[model samples]
Target: MAIELKDLAPLLLKAERTNGDVDPSVLTNVLRGGRVANDRRKELLQVIERHPVLSDRDMMYRNHDERYNFGIKKAFHYIKLLQEGGYTDPVDQQILYSAMGEPTAIEVHRSMFVPTLENQGDDKQRAKWLPLAKNYKILGAYAQTELGHGSNVQV
Candidate 1:
């Protein structure tokens, strides 16, 4: 089901009641351009509104695994809807980046690990490796964090 902005109204109200500062309007503006659209979007909003992390004072301080899992679950659902509706612009690098920062295997699998192989590897490599990776028959990780190399290591 696709989400219309109107369906998100009650979820916004509930969010305000529960989290106080989330401003469903923010998510509304970001995803829907302040226009209500469908039930799926509303469902996403409802989940966000009802989440225990809404009580958090700092978003970055929450458990990395938990936060990533939430973002991944939401993102996958949102991506599916956008793709089906012929709407390609709503979910972008920011959303995927947010999900990638999450510490869950699923998030890495869907957002990072998949893209890395698809974009960087050769066709033969992809054919050989992608199925295993996608099915979780083999697991992968980005273990490039450097002690002294800093963020510029990619250079």
Candidate 2:
């Protein structure tokens, strides 16, 4: 009798878990920064895994344009889920994105653009823009020179 590759994965994973000396939960907690964070990650992962729109299974079969459009769809659905679930914390949103295992179109907006506004924008700017960003009324993106190229204009 031959085992399918899919069937073998779980066996290998189970053996690895059983043979490991360290407790997996303890390791997970340490890696996730602590017990609270680990629990939050697990909870959000469950929500992501159960959502059809968030699944990444079909991504490999998509063309570049299809993938880009799919990413946008996933991003919108995820934001809606976050709003409905009341996941207001940025950390929770990050965990949810990590669980998705793929970058959405809005990732740069949330990760870079929003942080820039919060950090550098004046009080008046933040007062006007932060609420719009937070409420999903506006989406922002950050653009930069190619990697390894410094911000030198002459270059």
Candidate 3:
């Protein structure tokens, strides 16, 4: 099944809990890729000093429009850095997405399917089982409903 944005919101909250909100220093590192020298740090601050706020979508949009494109640009920058750093495997991408909460759907896939396979499938079974998951050949969902033997959902 295709994933929906509504289905992924909780995972984003979980991600913030799991990874903390995005760090300003991490953005600096993404731009410069090393410890900022004293002069560079001042320059960075000077750049921000003129703006009342910082935004994540500066790469894609004409200006800082947070709602539509924050994750898009941030994910773009992240994937570029990861490719530069030579971690190109799909599993590596999954892990990075799980850690950083972007490309919007990978975290939902991980939170739903990864542990489900590990806990609900057998050992040799899981080896064969996980390939589909890693490749997006299979899709999964996490549902809470007021039905069956499970507890109720208010909504």
Candidate 4:
């Protein structure tokens, strides 16, 4: 008799977990930096998973425009949650976003644009732009064009 597809997945997962001599938690902690960091990540994930807007269900069925709109909604809600939760640490924010699975449009603003301002901008520029960028009052984009390289921007 053949196993059902639904049954096969659980059986395989259970077998894999039970058969492994190495403890899964230990490996997870190492990857996450430590047990404390892993715990923090789990806490953040719980918050994200409990939110309806962040759910990945039906995402594959969405058209490009729908997906884009949905992503913006998720990003907005996620940012609000971060502020309400008092999560100012970049690492914590990154972990929470990673749990969301898909990259949202604001990701470029958070990951690239914000960092560039902090690192490269003068004090006056940082003072002027950081607040607006961080608060999402203005969204930022980075564009790089290499001459004679067509659309490829990579060096």
1-155: candidate 3 lDDT, tens digit per residue: 99999999999878876787778676677765555543444553443333322323233445545634655455445545454656546554544444442234344565777678978999897888787765555756676656664675455
The weakest ten consecutive residues by lDDT in model 2 span 146-155
Q: What TM-score would every model get versus the actual structure?
A: 0.36, 0.76, 0.35, 0.76
lDDT of 2 by residue, 1-155 (tens): 89899989999999998998998788989998999988878888999899998866588899999998999899999889888999989888888888888888988888888999899999999999998998688999776666566755553
Q: Flag clash pairs in model 2.
A: none
In candidate 1, stretches whose alpha carbon ends up further than 4 angstroms from where it belongs are: 1-30, 33-38, 44-102, 145-155
RMSD of 4: 5.1
Per-candidate RMSD vs. true structure? 13.8, 5.8, 17.1, 5.1
Local distance difference test values of all predictions, in order: 0.56, 0.87, 0.55, 0.86
Cα lDDT over the full model 3: 0.55
Candidate 4 local lDDT, 97-143, one digit each (tens): 88888889898898899999999999999999998888778889978
Candidates ranked, most accurate by lDDT first: 2, 4, 1, 3
lDDT, model 4, position 5: 88
TM-score of 3: 0.35
Model 2's lDDT to the true fold? 0.87
Clashes of each: 10, 0, 0, 0
Question: Candidate 2 at 98: error in angstroms?
Answer: 1.5
| Pairs with steric clashes in candidate 3 | none
